[model samples]
Target: MEAWYMDDSNEDQRLPHKLDPNVPVTLEELQKIGVFHWKLNADIYETDPELQKIRDERGYSYMDIITIHPDKLPSYEEKLKMFFEEHLHLDDEIRYILEGRAYFDVRDKEDRWIRIAMSKGDMITLPAGIYHRFTLDETNYTKAMRLFVGEPVWKAYNRPADDFEIRQKYVNSLAA
Candidate 1:
């Protein structure tokens, strides 16, 4: 729903003094609180059949829930390309960057692409059907934590995007 940038990143966002320790988290707490992480809920997604196929092929049932971390990623462009092109079956593509820099380009309902930048301690939640793309640079050395809100569990990027065809059988299977 929102992106949270590192506290130190906003040197000008600080307040005067601290707040009452017993008080609830307030403006002063927010301004002074360091950026830690971000998260997305699962109730927002609308499933796609392709996602179910990927799950079945992977010896899983549903691409229901998943988390993504950039730093722990492997170094494979081909694999990365496929990973990115495949649309998430669960619909809501969520992420929280723990470290580094990156940008996400997502397609809206009107077919418009919107790019949201992410850095350490940033959070982003992508609603279902919002086609999305992500890129990481040398400076993009980042680490992220993700949460998926679907059933079974599980579920990235590179190269020119590819088209994914949906078969009627798979759709029917998913519907059932």
Candidate 2:
């Protein structure tokens, strides 16, 4: 996974809008904001030991695959718009990329945007209540496995969700 500060460009969102100075963000720094990452063999992900261990440890009992593309998705444009909106979830947002690539933009403690580029074999878990957004990269396609602790929840509270308890707890976590 590659991460860096997103440039404030008005160009297409699919294009890599890397910052001018190219400041990179490391996995360790991402951890400070409650983001977790792992790289696993996508081809054998169903039986991959590392993935199994993570699921077991995290109590992820539900899983499903989603293909995001103009042709594959019913309301591709609508969905992409929603996905790109800064939002927070009541539960952790977990995704394991199996094909194509995308970017996950997360807000740092100072509210700066850090774009995380993810591709096949990459798995990322954005802890509950982190204001973030996702979008397909230049390829405009991605197949990902979504995991959940139990029943899957698709609700996303658009930003300015600071009133929520989950958001409060997340802010407190960063203070720690």
Candidate 3:
């Protein structure tokens, strides 16, 4: 996993968000900002009781696996286009990488992009209404577990102008 300021010139300044695998942060610190990361035990499995307990505690009602590769993407071109495009959902977007790598470009408090590179054992949840986009990293492949609070609804609002004001206010608040 990796995180850094997107602006190449300001490499030394610290951002409001942090990207440290060793630092432990609170749930409020995570959920309010619309982004969170956690490292899991390397040997974790889908059927593990610990994972199930987490699911129950987090209110996740369903889960599914998604694998993507160049060969598999041809048949999923339209769907891939949607994901690569900047968009937000009405519910949090949660993913746990079971294998491979991908980058999730999430908008910061200042509306700048922060690219989060994720790989195996990295779990992330992007809170609802935050503008973000996803794409495979250099490997061009990823296998992830998608979790949902209820039945899944794969709808994305592609930069809807009407909600920007409200969403931006919420994002700003998170920064505060």
Best by lDDT: 2
By the TM-score metric, which is better: model 2 or model 3? 2
Instruction: Rank candidates, TM-score, best first.
Output: 2, 3, 1
State the lDDT of candidate 1 residue by residue for 132-165, as single tens digits: 5565544535555554554523443222222323
Cα error of candidate 1 at position 96, Å: 0.6
Residues 58-175 of candidate 3: C-alpha lDDT, one tens digit per residue = 9989888888886765665566666878888878888989888887877766666677778888889888778888877657688888999989978888886435655666566676
lDDT for every model?
0.40, 0.95, 0.72
Q: Residue-pair clashes per candidate, as listed?
A: 3, 0, 0
* Clash pairs for candidate 1: 42-149, 83-156, 84-156
Give the worst 10-residue stretch by lDDT in candidate 2.
8-17
- Output the lDDT of residue 83, model 1: 44
Candidate 1 regions exceeding 4 Å error are: 1-72, 150-152, 155-176
Could you tell which candidate, 1 or 3, scores higher by lDDT?
A: 3
Of 1 and 2, the candidate ranking higher by TM-score: 2
TM-score of 2: 0.98
